[model samples]
Target: MAKWDNMLSMLWMLRSGRKLTAAQIADSLEISVRTVYRYIDALCASGVPVVAESGHDGGIRILESFKETPLFFNSVELKALVDAFKFARGACYPYTEELESALKKVENGLHEEQRHDLSHQTSGMDVISPSRPPSVVPLLRELEQSAKEGRTVRIAYRKANVEQADEREVDPYGLAFDRNEWYAVAFCHQSQTLRTFRVDRISRLEPTEARFEKPERFSTSAYFRNQSEREREADGPLAVIRIEGEPDTLNALCGHWHLRHYLTERTDREARFLIDVPTMNKYLPMYLMTFGTAIRIREPLELKRRIQEMAYGIAKHYENDPD
Candidate 1:
């Protein structure tokens, strides 16, 4: 098991409020007694306040202060947690039932005055989505189970822009949620390499009895970091767009949650963007049009030509409209 997983298991045991000794923890987790002690040291270093008592009858436990506080959250901590759940709920979280129940339990533990205060604080915040996406809860659960059990699953997957569904066997390593989407990062037997498949795109999933050992040093985070570096080095077409707008407008463009990763550089008077899309097709035109006259394509005459053509088409359509 990974050190992180081990730590989490230990934390859960301590959270149960039952006295657990290093020997008991090692036996349950099937790890060495020394490892249990090391994990305890790590927890203490990270401010967990895990108290260890020395003696034949003594054991380890979390500080009593945590037991009094619900999940060890103060009023401020409670507000932050509620705010996160609020955004996730508004975005149509897949596990809506679980989220609601958990939130209720947390609030139930609070005093009546605390609940009233939280209600006021939450009313001032909001997360708005045009439409709720379909729930990915079923798929999420299967993927999590497969990852934990080290089992291979046959998944019926639909690739983007492709209508046909293909079946493939994958060794699940971990699941990741990003940009309001969930993905399974796993070792693909079909592609003979690691690939990421969107959980929503998976139409059907069937877990198999076949199990595989996770690679010794494989990490989803490291894999993504290496993939990003490789993409940056790839030979791809680039477009330099000069942005001239107010400071706030420029900040808005840069600070957009989804667009922030693509931005390479910016300045006070102007900003330069490196476009990766090969063609100035529908996606590029539609995106650039959002900025209106505030942006100009500095290079790639092809892109400028396409935008001009699109602008002419729009003008023709609205030529006879009454103002």
Candidate 2:
């Protein structure tokens, strides 16, 4: 009969200064008056301060100030909350213990009927992410707090492939969880240059009394737009080239953030992209085959010649010719 469960529900319902008679409680609990009285005794025995007045105008009332009472849920709400946690479990952030503890409270609070529906046959779901050694979630939290409060912070940051960590004085602007990686974008005090530092590689944060002003136009979205290296590639010259490829591959390639602002096509087999590209990185002939015989590079003869020479070099790699 979920005796204790029903009594707890009754206490909560009466907590709002609303009186509930034995008959109403009994009907809601699908039990008899005799059982209701016994449950009321159970609550009082547990020091819940449940008061029941007798006679024609008697009812049940619990002393106020009870705030942590378990919530009442039907089957639908229970199912919805379960689904919510199932999805959160996929995010795979560092809240494992906390999330499970919160879920347990929900588990213990469910009414008997709803509990059955929740525990009934359902497919178990899981999230897949490469658990690359633990990273500092706490630092990200502190970084966010500092940025939001307009405070300055210090961090020992080591760039990728560097030998040592350097003390960086940064005025925090904002953090981004882009494509599953966390980036802290801010102004570097040492270099007097703006930079984006990866969150995982950051170690040790110290908050200081020094206050720093965030740039007025430092919108995170706008900052992200300028992160590409293509625009900064020497400013040597801009070139447009057309190539042909299958539609789906072209579609996926075109949508890449680096390519999106620069690509277009006249037909499924043919497309064009303009890149603010540098010179030394080109290996021409090999790059041309990327279109798989259906596409051709139509501009900048130097780029096309580079492609042809690279193809010859590659052919020489497998040929019997000594030259």
Candidate 3:
């Protein structure tokens, strides 16, 4: 059971015609008056129309309009919430304490039968995200708060491979978590464009007083999809590049999100992938060399030529030439 069950009980108590003092609520709930005040703060934070009163003959009560409204979540809906929380808890997001606390409250609200159903759902499921540094938790919390309030945030961000951190002011849109990491999608004022920042790479964060309106069409899912499409297109027109390789090589390619989706055919011996390597002349050689001779490029004579040039360059490096 959640220690903050008093929040619910206090709300129910305030729903009656009589206004209740903090001391009265504390006495009824058998907790300290200070605890009652904390529950009231929490209720207000959650958007409850709780009004506080002071002086003699004064107390607290919820708005009259809220009393008659009955809100409920069915078992399936509750289970969905539990599952989501379960996944999030495992995601490498900072500030999981609040999420765990909220999950506990949700669990405490469930009936025994519904809880049994939730238990069954939770028993066999697990999510595993790579570990993150403890320092990033505060930054994540600030970013989340800014996103919720539509406020701006300033941060010193460094890319994983970059040596210098850049100061940026951003309008936080939303956050995303994958199996490997957490990301914040934001519109950057410095770049005059939107960018994604790895949460762990953010070295410093501060919420600013400036607020911004979120674009109507902006969504994390859509943004990522479009970003990916642009990258694939930027490399030039899509080409059908077929490779003959061992099964492990195909499995390795399938591990990549873009490559996996475009994988048209797969067999124990080989796999065919249609991809756009726009910078083929620059990167194709390096990429092919990664798999060594285990793979062979079967199409697009252009890529084959580039690969040969790369191999020739490597061969030349070992040759003894007199100037």
Return whichever of 1 and 2 wins on lDDT.
Answer: 1
Each model's lDDT comes to 0.76, 0.70, 0.76
TM-score of each: 0.54, 0.52, 0.53
Per-residue accuracy of model 3 over 1-323 as CA lDDT, tens digit each: 24445566777788886889888888998999988888777677556788988988789989887744233455667667767776776674565677778878777755567679778866776676666788777777888889889999989999777899999899999887643677899999999999999998998888888999888877887777667666664656777777788888868866665555456788887777676677444545687777878888887888878888888998899788765
Off by over 4 Å in 1: 1-75, 91-96, 130-135, 216-222, 233-323
lDDT for position 301 in model 1: 71
Q: Can you write out model 1's per-residue Cα lDDT over 1-323, one digit (the tens) per residue?
A: 77767888888888998889889999999999999999887666556789989897789999877643224345667788888887776655657678878888888866567789888877888877546335467777788888888999999999999999999999989877666667789889999988999887898989988999888877776665566545553456766656667777788777654355556788875666665655334356777777788776665676778788889999999999999
Residue 119 of model 1, lDDT score:
87
For candidate 2, report its TM-score.
0.52
lDDT of 3 at 95: 55
**Residue-wise lDDT of candidate 2 within 1-323, one digit each (tens)?**
56556877777667878778988888987889998888777666445677888887777887776554545555656666676666555544445558778878877755455567787722454456545435556777788889988888999998899969989789889987665567889888998978888887787789988888888877865677666543554666667766556787666556555655555455686667666657224422444556455546566676667777777787888898755
* Candidate 3, lDDT over the whole model: 0.76
On TM-score, the candidate that comes out on top is: 1
